[model samples]
Target: MVQYNEWMKDVNDDAKLSSLSVPGTHNSAACHVALPSVQCQGASVTDQLNHGVRFLDIRCAKLFLASGDDANDLQVIHGKFPVKIPFPLKLAKVLDEVYAFLQSHGSETVIVSLKQEGQDTWDNDSDEFPKVIWENYVRPHQDQWYLGSGIPRLGDTRGKAVLFRRFGVKDEQLSQNLGIDAHWWTYNTTDDDRGEIRVQDFCELNDTNDVQKKSDYVKQLTSQAIQYNATNPADPKLFLNFCSGSNFFNPECWPEKIAQCMSDANIQDCFGKGCGIVVLDYSEKDDYKLVKELVDKNF
Candidate 1:
């Protein structure tokens, strides 16, 4: 059996990050969530990393512990649901695992799309909000990250996590001062601009959409993102396509089911040679074949 690891080592250092077919997981830390509707991934961060997942969609928040002793530095969450490790661990622990994995596999670079979830907000009114995050997560682990704003090559970030912030700490200057402005993007599609990395997060809101419809939607978004990267060429535009969706009203929108539908629909063939960052759900099953399918497109 082949022990697949450090696949990105095959890619040249001059190859643009935008040109790589990055396999990512949406709500990557939500595997511990008990609810079927909210859980997005079936693999732990380390497992996903071993499975050739290069991008991680991490949602975090500073929260009070269950014992009410003190707030954890950061907790990986999925909307209102709290995902925990065996006994429970902070977001920092998960990141440590990612860091260790990269350290062991020197040729692999990981993209961490870090976003704030829950009631926490990076507002100017409360300076402590962003301050706590910096002092705890960013400051302590600064050395393990690539904070550059530009799209870096694989060699530039190997054995490191490239930070893609999704929260606004303050005004333009203030956010920059807080170090939150380095390669950040608007929260949603409505606020998206063509100049920065564009994202498509289309999901079935009412579950009225059938499996075929949702599959087609994923294909359309995937194709457009690949085309965008092709035409932009020189521009460092990245297209993040979210292949995860859910509907509280219908179990059909569950992530596992959606992933199955995608696999059955043969959508992987539509990804072509450059699909940018393709984030998926339920990627742990089938030896993470879905993620491998996307990564294979880079060749």
Candidate 2:
């Protein structure tokens, strides 16, 4: 039996990372938040990794502490005050989990799509943000992180969190454009979508109660992903399709509900060959069935 955690170890290293079907979690650390719409995940980082989720969508903010010292650490945040994480210790805890997982599973690599949020007091200072990230997070643990921009080989990034920075850059040298915007779009941005690894964030639920309509949208996107990946088998590209949504007014379009739509057996069958990296919400529930299906497709 294949180990649930180290499934990526079986993937061929010669193949480009972009070509493989990786399961990602959007707002991966939002499990602790109390709000309805912003909470995208239900599992901790270690649990998600153990469940075969190779990609992680992390949103962070630089928070200033009250001790006259700014604790340059990254705090996970979704929206403004209400949806933000309560304390700074959470980031440390999460990183500890990531480090432990990678140390044990040297053959697997994780992708962290990092974006900045919340009120940044250092907006006036151009170099502070990147410096904070470098000094606090990336520099001390440089060996454990894959800091490059372009898609990397699986072997090179093994046992590391390949940083995909989505935050603003003051120091270009800090990330080397590795943290480029993920090119997230709605349902109609199909024309401009062209890349070796394409991503679509079509989680807009106009009508919160319309479950059937949301399901149809998810099905349509998955079908398109199948066709997109099939176009070039020899040199396949990634299709990051998001199965997450939010509606402040109606809890029906919450992250869990959106994930349920993607959980259908018919939808899972669409990725029999592969579905690139399917980012989901509320992935900790349902025994991580959706993520397991994606990982199984890799082998």
Candidate 3:
């Protein structure tokens, strides 16, 4: 039997990050006291990591300080709302949790997908979001991150947080070393192939009737990842299949409801195979069944 906490220890060091089946959570740190629409996860980040989830979908909103204060910070958010109610969750704190987990479990590596969420009032030239992240969050702890632009081997990333940057860069030099360039990812897409990374993030469900369509997209991407990895094991593109969606206006199509619908869609057929990163909402439901099934594929 594979242990949830240290499951990566069983995987071979030569395995590429893009080829392995990784379990991930969408809005991973949004498990606090927030509205149902904003809260996408049921378990805390620490719990997710301990339960064999190697990928984290973290959305950070840049909170600029006073006029001249250089000590700006990034707060975790979902869409335009803060994940936590009154007191917001900070990205630095989340990174600390990841680092602590890696220190204890030296064989495991966590892929953190960082996206700039919420409104952007700051000027792009004066305050570029990627540059802010690079200076404020990443530069301070550069050693703890895998900032390479290409897919990394598991051996090279052990005990490190692999950065999957989802924000754009204005400076030409900053763009060169700012992690895997998922900056050109399309929104609410069923299939957006950007060479190094492919995405299936069809997040808009017009109604409950659209759940099946969403599930179909999930399965299709899963098959693509499995087939690609099986044939070209040495070089594989990272596939991020998001099994999360909502209608926004319809309460029935909320995240939890969509998650329940997805749970019943018999999506398990996509599991126990190399399907890249399976990002889910409410991943803790059914005792982390989705995470466990995906993790088992490695062994």
TM-score of each: 0.87, 0.85, 0.96
User: lDDT: which candidate is best?
Assistant: 3
Worst 10 residues of 3 by lDDT: 63-72
Looking at model 2, the pairs that clash are: 165-179
Query: Worst ten-residue run, lDDT, model 2?
Result: 183-192
lDDT of 1 at 43: 72
lDDT of 2 by residue, 40-125 (tens): 87778889998889888877665546422355556676755323445443455567778899999999988887666677666534
Q: Summarize candidate 1's per-residue lDDT along 1-299 as a digit string, tens digits.
A: 22346788888887878788888898887888466777787778898988888889888776644423246467777776666643444788888888899889988888887777776544446655456666677778787887776677777888888877766565454455342142344433322445647666666545635667766766886787688777876776676777777776688778888887778888787786677888888887688877887777777
Over 1-299, each residue of candidate 3 has an lDDT whose tens digit, in order, gives 99999998888888889988999999999899998898898889999999999999999876534243332577888988889978878888999999999999999999999998787565677536777788888999899889998999999999999999887777778877778878787789999997878999999999988999999999999999999888887667899999999976899898999889889997877775678999989999999998999999888
Per-candidate count of clashing residue pairs (backbone under 3 Å) = 0, 1, 0
Query: In candidate 1, which residue pairs clash?
Result: none
Error of 2 at 52 (Å): 0.4
Work out how many backbone clashes candidate 2 has.
Answer: 1
**What lDDT would each prediction earn against the true structure?**
0.72, 0.69, 0.88
Give model 3's TM-score versus the native structure. Answer: 0.96
Error of 2 at 131 (Å): 2.8
